[model samples]
Target: MKVWKSVVSAALVSVLLAGCGSNAGTDNEQNEVKAGSTVNLKVFVAQPRLKEHYDKYIEQFKAKEKADKNIEVNVQLEMPPADNAPQILKTRLASNDAPDVFALHAVNEIPPFSKAGYLEDLSNQPFVDKLLDSVKPSVTDASGKVVAVPLETLSWGYLYNKDIFKEQGLEVPTTLTEMKAVVEKLKAAGITPFELSYKEAWVPQLFLPLTVGALTQTEHKDFVEKMNKDEASFSDMKALFDVFDLVNANGTDKALEVGADDGAAAYATGKAAMWIQGPWYAETILKSNPDVNFGVAPMPLNDNPDDTKINLSTSTSLAVSSSSKNKEVALDFVNYILDDKDSSAFYEALKFNPVAKVHTFKSFPWVDDALKYVNEGKAYQDPKIPQAVKDESGKALQGYYSGQLNQQQVIDALDKAWKSYNKVNK
Candidate 1:
């Protein structure tokens, strides 16, 4: 999910031929020529790791579009690098000449683009009917403009080696104290109970939510929407540092000694008993050994043992360019991939939870419980601050991860970033 490939932040654009995509003779003739000799459909994505899925989808799309006598589809794919996608997409969108379809890393990216009239409004579009009610909000603008289609969702949680649990005769901690005790117990057994990497810098900062979820008992499931209204403040982010204190108390920085990739590797090899990661950890850890028995659970609420709530509340989204001369065709292509029925196979291949009518929690049992929880009126989207705030947060966390700042300093920096970033747009 976070590892999706090359995009700048939401600032992206793509020039279209006069008739880049339209029927040879149709009322929407403006879009009729996208495929003159060949209709070129350029797309941007975040998950390059999921290329196989896109390649297959493209092949199918090409076949279907070519079957039509009037239009042809050419698929050009690109993704943003691992870090700073929000930054990259922002740059591209500002450049004016960008891609036809691109991924929106978060709902926040869509607003500025929507304000700029850069994304197509699909609220009343046919594809809007096919998405799950739960997924639609992530793509809609404040004006309720549907700038993108909901693809799949990514949830966050703590993943532990079930085998390790059994070996230690430890039950999954349901209470806050027990959770920390579990960490302590594992450490006493000469095991690092958690995995963390400061090199990527954002790693530990990202995990702060696990603690926040535990602390609030998941009361702030709408943290994003609330933050959007200027009601929330990152300056009050002492909650975040409290979460990191667990990592510090446990002296788990040994894992931080490694890079993000290697820290996950350590977990895969059984050197670490627990990990705070999202579903992507499945693929990352599996690379070493798919057989590693891991169990997924919501991050402890307020560290509450029995509180089994907190939504892994966000997803990367897919959207069409407003400049597309082939509006109808582009919409059709996006709908073909994201609509309920088609999205089942699409979600399976992409390994994300389906947010479309076609997806079932059962289809992704690994992530099902989390998605089910989200659909059942739980989960919260990540706070989508302005580009400035986001980069500031990332940089601040990077500093935290690298031990460049002490705990209080980390919180202060986030407060500064959030305020400064929000100030510009305000």
Candidate 2:
């Protein structure tokens, strides 16, 4: 889901007001508006790819609010790039100018914000009652408080072109050895085996965290704990490098230079037979080539078929600001979006899988397949590693892919980085 990076400017904030609506009254007046008066609630979101869906929901929610509570809901939408959103939101909250409502990652991203008391606790909110049982644990904190409403439960895996697989008589590989044979066949047939976009450091870093899940299942369930205690090191986890070698060997020669959009284009145009990504990229790929047929499977990280599993977690969630002047209205808006009727429309508009208990909605085949693993608890969430460690690990992987460092050197660097980060953060 780490797609783009762009600075959020003051000018962009000004533009968002025009996009939503004109400011009808003073900030204080708007905040203290009576039931019958028009009130504006600022909503900060990061998914630019789903802008149309958000726009539609804003209009729908406004109409519903006016009808139910006689208050005109003006939704000012501010969308920074996904990669820049977390820092921007943190800064805004710290400055006491937090958005009335905002989108955030459910796992690693939410803890610090919740600890700092920036998010409103929604544990007893009606929307929390509607969340699917499978998704409930993600939105709840360690203290069993529901801090955010689950938006989308996403899965990451290898996306393959069904048409190419069918035409070439290639079966979906469930093991690393099988995957290598498939890659060889694809390459022999003059098809790029994988679409790798390493220029976006976040993209390459994804596999590392995902591999942690597979490793936990097969080798060490307490790997993260041991690492934190300085009893374990990345050098001890050599299976990850083996998986990297397979991917790097089959990827496009210019992968290190390819950005996200370029990688999507290559895969959608049938230049590559597969791409490792999450369900978030499905819309973009389909938009690029409507005729392209694809399906998703867990990343085959090891030779044992049982060792591979999809990476699944709540990729995004919605929360109201604890300090919002219009907390009631903001909470109401959150409730409406998480409601079954409105939430279904929101997911349908964006073509995203629902995290709510909406049993009638049918997911894309790829998403449905990934959900099987999720239902069985075979999916993994990224460990709550520090952002600095994630950044360092990504750089190390880039070095490995670029032939600037050997596998052992990369592991040593990651272990060193982790120990240093732990000491500083502690």
Candidate 3:
């Protein structure tokens, strides 16, 4: 058995594979080593609740490594509490005890790691050619650099209970007006209409991407640019606020009383009829109650007839660590997760939409529909913004939810933070 399959470096360059090096002996020679040296790889991850997603894949990788190269791969999946992963990672890096590979949320976050000289450019990884064009931007820098492998493509929607819809005699609400009506219907039927976890604060930022989605569709394709330039504010979200009033209208305050995990529980238990969440919640929902019927729909358009924000754009990406000693391995790993059938299957099992177009899903029509969302010109990714603004805005929303700040106060906080972000990020 060939332990390490020889990777002949081609023109693509996501990782600097040895075969591509001009003087690294020959590809075949470089693929192997003497009888018994240890070639171990350590990985760090910040994505919580994804232990199962990586555990199995790492097993496959390890099996291949041992069979092909007499190499022993030591993989450690570390998901610091979601809130603390970055801080822990920074602390570890400072101590020079950081894992060779790690996880990050977006490209802007990647730049900081890259600037610290901790990542390898992934433009030429083996799987690069297999990615769907729609997902390319998720893992890319402004200069077209593929700094990391994009593991999944995500979209936001109301993860709702079909059972509740049936019990309430409600169909999928086609528009924001319709959704509001549905919310009222659910409330009258004694079901809490929405699940919101304002304690975590980041819950509302989910609305930001979707709100901007609507804004882009209606009167301002440059809303993101304006936000980035600090010339605009979340104040433009008044119409979207209508959805919030509808959501919280009927004592959904229980949502704010608990953390996100419990809020998810509230919905999963059939207490709450709807939850506007990313695909990440699928696992917990299934584990808690596989019998519950659920469906996903993009955020509905604003109820006001004159409103124009029709698109709801949400996405996720992956970036490579600039500090890997095994750039080839890192790139190969990224490719497998992004595009390979087996790897994509693993992710599909994890409930994330694969970024590659290759994994044709004949069973789940919804997955296919989500992929076509961008092609239909109905949705898009937000223009890259600064982390500070994202964080502070999330904090502001949390404050508003807790009544610690009024709507105006939230807007003021967001406006000031965004202006500051523009100065530093730009």
Candidate 4:
């Protein structure tokens, strides 16, 4: 049988294969390999939600390796929550015990690692040609090399319960004024217009990206550049604060106490009409309430309908370790996952929109709608801002949500953080 077919078959029989006791070792024992032995490659993946799918793909990868190379391959799969993986991976890399392969965010996450000489350059790989041109910028490094295989493109917006909107006789809002009016109507009907989970600092900050994209579409195309150069401040973007105020004023009571999981559950159970998030929460929401019909749309940012645009970019990419003992095997495995015949299955398993040109995604109406922006080049991805600035921005947004910092204070804090970060990083 061909490798791809064998991989598909292995996926089917993965449960039985799970008991085979693959001899993959941990980072502590990675260097203790016997002479003339099977290859072992450790793969660190951050998507805890897709552990099963990754495990199945790894099994398929192993089966294919044995068939094609006549050498047994043991893949040690390390699964971690998205929130904690980067720090752990960083520690491991700094200690010279990096995994053979790992998943990382394309932009802000790649630079430090790549500059530190921890990532292998995959620019000339065949898989690089398969990626959607639109996503190439995010995965490309300062050296003009594609350092990773982009696995999925993600878009953030408002996930609204279509059923609730239809029953309430409300059209999906396309402008900020319309959105505020809809919120009032929903509130009048005793429904929470927006679900805010400010306890999870990142949740409240979701509004920023959509707001940023809308600003870029209207008047701030050089926003990221100016911010990086210290020539502009978040205060310059008053529209973002206006949108933040609209969302905070319309959120559920006790929203400051809600976490991401609780907020998702609330939206899933019809406790709220809207939740600002990306496609990452779709599975969780569907699992919570399979019958609830939902769709995603750009966050309406102003009175002009055309000003709204989705924030789209390569959300995850796979990269090989520069210091790996098994670089050849790692490269092969990365290529296998992205090959035309296998890429769709890998993406489908994660329920993510594919970044490869070989696949087509039509699963969700909101995803389809987001694709229209992508095709028309109406989407936006923030440039490579310093990690310190990114982290501080989240805190600033949370403070705004809690009224602990006024609008100007939040902007000042971010501007200060950005300047300080540039001094050190530059």
Most accurate candidate by lDDT: 2
Please provide, for model 4 over 1-426, each residue's C-alpha lDDT reduced to its tens digit, 9 standing for 90 to 100.
110111121121222223123211222222443434599789998766667888888888887777777657888889876545655776676556779999987876687666666678899888888887887878888888888988777876778888889989998787888998899899889988888876755566566666666786667778877886888887767787778788888878777677777787888999889888777777777778878888877887778877777777676788987778887788888988786777687787677776778876545666886777667776666545554555556667776666677888777866787676555445
Q: What lDDT is reached at residue 102 by model 2? A: 94
**lDDT (Cα) of model 4:** 0.72
List TM-score per model, in order. 0.80, 0.85, 0.81, 0.84
What is the C-alpha RMSD, rounded to one decimal, of candidate 3? 9.5
**Who wins the TM-score comparison?**
2
Error of 4 at 320 (Å): 1.3
Clashing residue pairs in candidate 2, if any?
A: none
Q: State model 2's lDDT.
A: 0.74
Instruction: List candidate 3 stretches off by more than 4 Å.
Output: 1-35, 86-98, 107-118, 304-316, 326-328, 338-341, 357-377
TM-score of structure candidate 1: 0.80
Candidate 1, which ten residues in sequence have the lowest lDDT sum? 10-19
| Backbone clash count for every predicted candidate, in the order shown | 45, 0, 21, 0
List where candidate 2 sits over 4 angstroms from the true fold. 1-33, 372-378, 403-409, 416-426
Better of 1 and 4 by TM-score: 4
